[model samples]
Target: MDVRVLGRGPAEPFLGAQDLFETEYDLSMPVRVRIRRDPDERTWTGHYPDHHVLNISAQAATSAMARELALHEYAHMRRNEEAHPSHTQSTAEALYLALAGRRVERRKLTHCYQIANHMKDIYADDITLSVAPADKLVAFLEASLATALADRPHDPPRWQRLTPAADPDITAVNAAFALALCERHDLLTPDHRLYDLAHAAADDAPGVSIERFKHRFKTLVDDPDESEYRKALVDVTHQYAVETGQAAD
Candidate 1:
């Protein structure tokens, strides 16, 4: 897959890996990866960002987990992390409102607002949120494509490598958005990304223990006995169900 330098601005050389990469690796930003010492050469260490990087240590990565990570990082890079995040209440929202100009619609905005809140909760521990509904994200993609097509009709995204989300910089926004949406869907089903990844590996470390995973997840939300986590989870689930037309309560 050709590394698509996010359509926001002028394309430049890709980043990372001096010895291994002959050419630039088109990686988007907010990139996250785990670094490991190469088994063959402990003197040299290998860096594996989410999964866009072609050079990966097979022994280091567990199947497609690395790939998923790279993709996730790439999506973060491409999506609304730069000038505009996917969801910001004040000026940012107004900006998207101006550009999309009532085209954005209330549902998307509200949904994205919820998306922001989730991100806030997720990153509350430490990571931090730059901007969710980043203006650069939507603006860049929309403007880029609008300009690109204005000259001559181009292709309709060759292989869905990454999606064009709102905001600026990178090209993985769509992937991130879709993935987040899927995760939200799954979680309302109350599944964690870890569980999904573990099951995908199917390593058979032990018997399938969904209950064990749930217990672990309950800790993750900071003691389900605590009112805030429980209430938030309940509200998020209810909202999802109501929106998706699967509302039981």
Candidate 2:
């Protein structure tokens, strides 16, 4: 698949700072940027495996805000690259902090965030952790991948630091979190549609894009007893796939 940026309008002149970042930033790949007066997504950037930004769009954000959001997204790409001595920003996390990113910051360390940080630790200890156990206490860092994938199909305005796109495989981790959260509390109605959708997405014949698949999967968590609706939706999704040429290939 290819990511093509839709440049529907006149390209906005590159502001001085963005121009500078475009020329001087440590981007691993070239990113196409387009500013819009009104975008369905407040601020979003898509990237292909080519490491290029397929599209970066924002609807009239101040230069400072755009700069910060760009830096924030950049951190997601350069996340694993350790900083050299010449580089001041060591980890992507550090770079985010340096840029004053993150919508929420705990004055003290948080148990939820810490637990997510220690997911590897729990595995290392060889202790069997219950799936429903850590519903609300997973670390932000650990759950980061899930949150990223979740936002791709529905990139809302506010999910910063937690809304970068991720690979489809990461959805399982989030699915686990959803189930665990529901088990701990009955927030989900029994007729939820997502349970079946998740199974369908995991099935050999996933009939939609990963983001769409996940959106459908989340439908269950929102309604637990909607089995008939879920069935009809599945059939509709399959029929739509056939009509749209997805099923042919």
Candidate 3:
């Protein structure tokens, strides 16, 4: 496998990450990696499966976050090669629920995509951590939780300004709950601080309790039964729409 690092940044760190990823995983084809700064980029790194390109943000590269990002994206690339019927099914169900209603707006549909993508992240994180070093994975999870906690509002407004009906607090809690579920399942190490932060966020969100939220999240991502998984997705999407005042007709 030929791994090339492009664009300007600290080449050594990125090269080191590439070396580690190549050594740990088998790549049958060439892949291009680059680091670029984008203020609007929502992720630390993204994998373009079709182009076989991986892009890491300059900020993430400088902070040593590129290592995990690379490995995570590599896992995604590998998964792309091996078909996952379950992911395909679940994603389809979520999208159907998200767009089933006549009231669906672009932003609302985008929010559904966000939730579905995060659901995929849980599976990808599992694959990456399976082969990657446990300590390194733990460190990455810790850093991720710390960043989420820092950026989260202590008392968020009931609804986002742009999406008046969508409760930002609930969305944040759901995201945190996904990570917390990973920790619970041993994909990531359990950290009291991370759990506390998730719990606190749930507490502040009306009608959301920590334990109940965890159960729903687990059902959404980890449930073995396909029917139950679809049901969970429907329930989650319904809740989001209800909270946002965009319930389907």
Candidate 4:
């Protein structure tokens, strides 16, 4: 893996940890990881699949967050190349509701995206937690969860012209789910706030167990039976919405 640093200061520690990351994650593939300062401060970190590059905001990277962010992005890369599924299923579920003559709130569809991505983050965080120090991981989870809870959107637009695929809440929900999983795995001390945030973010699309969601998400991306997968996904999500009282009659 080739690690490159564009701007100085905040990204230096992330660059320095490149070797440690490779060793810990057993990353053997040739990928270029780039760390740059985000002038806009719009996001904590991001992964660009086309360029195989990871971009970290200057504020996030400088604040002792680079290690975990790197690990998170590394997990995303591995999943993208290996086991990860497309995020389109969430959008599809929303479309299913629309086609069925149900008025789907944009927020509900966005929650669906959140649920799917959060599940993936749980897996990603698992990989990161495996190699990171226990104390550091615990601290990271604590801080990240607090940030997620504080940043939760209280008044999201009731409707939007954009598809659920464009929703930005995935990032917030990802952090919440990561923390919830950390609490579940005893990586962090039990905290009701973490649980609350996780469930609240997922409240719109309820009744589906996390395990079931994980299975469905994986099948949606990994199953060779494309037609069956699509049908099953739509059926399952529609049933879930109806049962949860999220679907219009």
How do the predictions measure up, each by TM-score?
0.21, 0.25, 0.71, 0.61
- The digit string of per-residue lDDT tens for model 4 on 1-249 reads 666556554555655556556666654454454445565553333445444566666666676666667766676666555534432234555446443777656666656655645545655666666666656666665566556545544555334534333222343335444555665456644564555555654553344444344344434333334355446546545644554455576
lDDT of each: 0.31, 0.35, 0.59, 0.53
Q: Please provide, for model 3 over 173-246, each residue's C-alpha lDDT reduced to its tens digit, 9 standing for 90 to 100.
A: 45466555465556544554556656555655555444654556555444345565566666666666566554
Counting clashing residue pairs in each candidate, in order, gives: 29, 14, 1, 0
- Lowest summed lDDT across 10 adjacent residues in model 2 is found at 123-132
Preferred candidate (lDDT higher): 3 or 4: 3
Evaluate candidate 2 by giving its C-alpha RMSD to the native, one decimal: 20.4
Q: 1-249 in candidate 2: lDDT tens per residue?
A: 111234553232223223433443345555555555555655544545554452344453443334344433443333223221211222233223322322222311122222232221222111112211222233332344334444444333232335344423334334444444343344445655445434433442233244443333333332223343334233323333342232223
Candidates by lDDT, descending order: 3, 4, 2, 1
- Tell me, by TM-score, which candidate is best: 3
CA shift at 197, candidate 3, in angstroms?
0.5
| Runs off by more than 4 Å, candidate 1 | 1-34, 37-60, 80-82, 86-117, 120-180, 183-249
RMSD (Cα, Å) for all candidates, in order, is 20.6, 20.4, 4.6, 6.4
The digit string of per-residue lDDT tens for model 1 on 133-176 reads: 22222333244434422333133423222443322111122223
